[model samples]
Target: MVLETSSTAEASIRAPADEAAAERDLARRAQRGDPSAYAQLVRGNQGRILRHLLNLTGSRDEALELSQEVFLKAWEALPSWRPEARFHTWLYRIASNVAYDLLRRRQLVSFEPLPPDHDTPAETDSPEVRLHAKQTIGQLDAALARLPPEQREIVLLREVEGLSYEELAAALAIDEGTVKSRLARGRAALAQIYTRMQT
Candidate 1:
């Protein structure tokens, strides 16, 4: 089921302790085969998961499809759920694996970036300014596409998804040191690419 955008934002603003308690409760219920609890989990996480996948794959359609797969996998794996990791981090790990598998099957290196959605206020900007903004976004997207998949994944997880070092290590199944090293390299590479594009 599609979650409303407003609800997602509301979920994000919730107190962390309260949210974690709720998530743990829901996870417990879901592990016990409660469909409603599973549905709640999906509603809570769908937006961020979709956004993360979109940035990773650079295609809304692919992201949407892969997100469905992610939820399904999560459902199937619920019985094995342990609270050792945060539910969202587990979901991200699933999403990363799903995106990587699809990219491999399709033999795609990267996707061309689409224009930004209508979130930017049209009333505030002149056409020339809007055009420039789009161009810059496009340039950055191309630079992101040029990164190796491992580097790209690290950059997207750290920068776009805002995963912490520990969270990123959990999601990517790497040690924290590896996450730090890859992120540093990824940021350096992205900066170089962006610079070259500007020149």
Candidate 2:
């Protein structure tokens, strides 16, 4: 039994130890000329990346195209990848930078459609829920657009990605205090907008 247990343990180790191990394995395999690992990585992140692009760029079509481009870029850069950071965090940083670069080049990003999220409510409650949700989201989008790009990025990093202050700092290449200060200021501005919405 002891020998059997040891063999199983060794087999599991040969498989993957954990997420970090898997990340390293996938990265190495991709680096050593495995296309499937890169495909798997792209599949794992496609949805999240597209949604984030949707929010950041405000265009579903562009988001889709950019997500593809992000994967292509990732494939090209995979050999350079060092697992010094969370893979998703690194991917997101790249996507964010890509979106920013595209925006900078075009001088604007097209706005996303603002149809309400009326799908998450009970049939009876959906009307009211959607009404309020639309108003709130509309106000948020307006205020978000009005904010400077850096401020909007911070706000979305906090609220949408749910990155911690330390994580946001690392992702944005800013300080933790700056993350906190930006969050506070951004929320305050959002509050003012919501209050005006109430009035």
Candidate 3:
């Protein structure tokens, strides 16, 4: 006699806990040697991790390889993970270490614009508009490249990754005040560079 709505059905199928709680539960399961739970966690985080690495390394190939390494390291260290810390933040700390090590070893200075992930009107617009968009992206990449690695990393994590100051601190093993100052300086430097490029 009762017809269930789609939303109600979805609600029933989904967990009652919030997303953070759900992630914690998954982390606990993963720590218990549940491959499926670990796989789910990887799937949830892989895209953001890949995009972040791509921006940091400036190469799609390097990003792909580094993403695999990050997951491998994460899985290996999962047993030591503390439940008090956020799972994603812990993973991010690992990722930051991996990336910074590679950057330092290579003394990498080259950079490329991130590949467009969205289909925007610019893509369908006139050739001139598309060209302008491409130039802007390139300019942005050049500006980012000019920043010191620390500032660039903080800027990307804060702006591109949308991580909070506290999250950035945790990920980079720095204090929240440091994160804020670095982000502010990075923004100011980036603005100066971008403005010069515009002129």
Candidate 4:
């Protein structure tokens, strides 16, 4: 459901050719007044949209509501989607902006878990190793909670989404230099916290 589209910026996202082509084709058809085609597009993208919302809201219930809202908004704005930008880019931009707006309005703290797909910890060679690994991950998660939302978002985009500076910039509506600086500072702060935890 990802690969085959030349417009997709994510080089690593792999999906069937027919599926990818079907998305653009459906989108193209939807633009041309095919209601069923639009439904297909929503079905194809709902999982990704939900994941984005879940990450942003840190609650499955809230994510489901927000995801529904995103699709509703997408449907309303579909006609305005410029052909120059990839469909996913347009969708993500809208979703991110909406999430930002919602967060600003709610003044809520995000309690999102460490991404489930984070790099795997090596298997423990001993009980001590297992304990240490658990302790380290817990410490990191605690430290992550202490970070500013901007810093946390940057970390998530880079580590979980695997987006580069350019993609990160676009996703966050920031400049490339800003992305680099934020990432550097975020890493430095994380290192400082981890160092403190060791003592």
Candidate 5:
């Protein structure tokens, strides 16, 4: 279920309208209680959603649990879904809410620094390269962890999840202008953090 980010970006750029149409059709069928349609939706999206949650929470176990909750919530709410929003956007909204709720409940929780299995280096990588990669990821994780929840969410959705500005606005219940502003601020903050870490 490890989705290639390049594929996601290519797909998003290639035929968003066609993809939306297909998702809408599946959603309609799922709303009508088509188990196969729902399963297909889950299979297609689970990896992306889990990756986003992992980036947000920095914990694979929490991400996995929250992802299951997200799909379940999506299923229960499927009947009321309107096709005005893309299916992935709607699911992202749900996932964001779930992550935010968890963050609120466990305020200031300490996340482990890049769990072993979360993003392992390739076996072919030299030890020095692997160490460098791990250190970079750790710095990035620390920077993300320090961001305000809203800013962090925006950054992850835009940068890590490769969500379009429109999708981010819909998923976060913000306007596109707001998405741009927040993304700018988030990136700036992250840059500052990285610079400080480097020093």
Candidate 6:
């Protein structure tokens, strides 16, 4: 049993590296104009890209529309894509640009409350506790919508999407120092806004 558990742990740790390698191979094939390979790459990444866009745009309809545009732009640019960057990271760069453009054109930020979480607090939490949790999530979402798009994107990509500093820089076409400073400011602003909302 112990050996089985150890093996499972090791396999879990290796999964991301394995997935990245597979994606790189697919990207190379797509670069050579293989439609099937490109489809597979899109299938593997679309959900995450969609979710990321949804967070950035705060609109489901816009996110769905922008996700298709991101993939289309990726296909057009595939020939120039380098293997050194993770395929997903490159896709996100395209997505980031597309989203930023939309935000700039709209000149407004709006966020609905995040979808209700069905799995949290176990089944035993009191109604009051559950209500409080829901309210807190709503407040956080509102705070995010209030932030400038530039800072909001950094905060979402770092905290919500779990990107490392280097990945954030590559995805946003910014330097690591910029990513760090923006994320710091974004987080501080979010905290202040959330605090104000709670009072």
**Every model: Cα RMSD to truth:** 6.8, 6.6, 4.9, 6.5, 5.5, 2.6
1-199, model 4: which lDDT tens digit per residue?
Answer: 4455654754435454455566778788888878898888888778777776666666677778887888888888888875554566567777777777788888867555555433346675577886677677767766765667778767766875676686677777789999999999888887887788778
In order, how many clashes per candidate? 0, 0, 0, 1, 0, 0
Ten contiguous residues minimizing lDDT sum, candidate 4:
111-120
TM-scores, each model vs. reference: 0.86, 0.76, 0.84, 0.67, 0.87, 0.87
Q: After superposition, how far is residue 3 of candidate 3 from its true place, in Å?
A: 23
Q: Report model 1's TM-score to 2 decimal places.
A: 0.86
Per-residue CA lDDT of candidate 3, range 56-171, in tens? 88778888899999999999999889887778888888877888888888987655555554223355689988877777777788888788778888898888878888778888
Clashing pairs in 5: none
* Candidate 2 per-residue C-alpha lDDT over 90-199 given as tens digits, one digit per residue, 9 for 90 to 100: 67777888888878887874444323451233557678786776676777776676666667777877788777786677677778898898888888876786677667
Using lDDT as the yardstick, the better of models 2 and 5 is 5
Question: What are the per-residue Cα lDDT tens digits for candidate 6 across 75-178?
Answer: 99998899999899998889988988897898765555445551255458899997777777777878888888788888988887788999899898889999
Off by over 4 Å in 4: 1-23, 109-139, 194-199
Give the true-structure RMSD of model 5: 5.5
Q: List runs of model 5 lying over 4 Å from the truth.
A: 1-14, 109-112
Worst 10 residues of 2 by lDDT: 112-121
Could you give me the TM-score of model 4 versus the true structure? 0.67
Residue 2, candidate 4: Cα error in Å is 27
Better of 1 and 3 by lDDT: 1
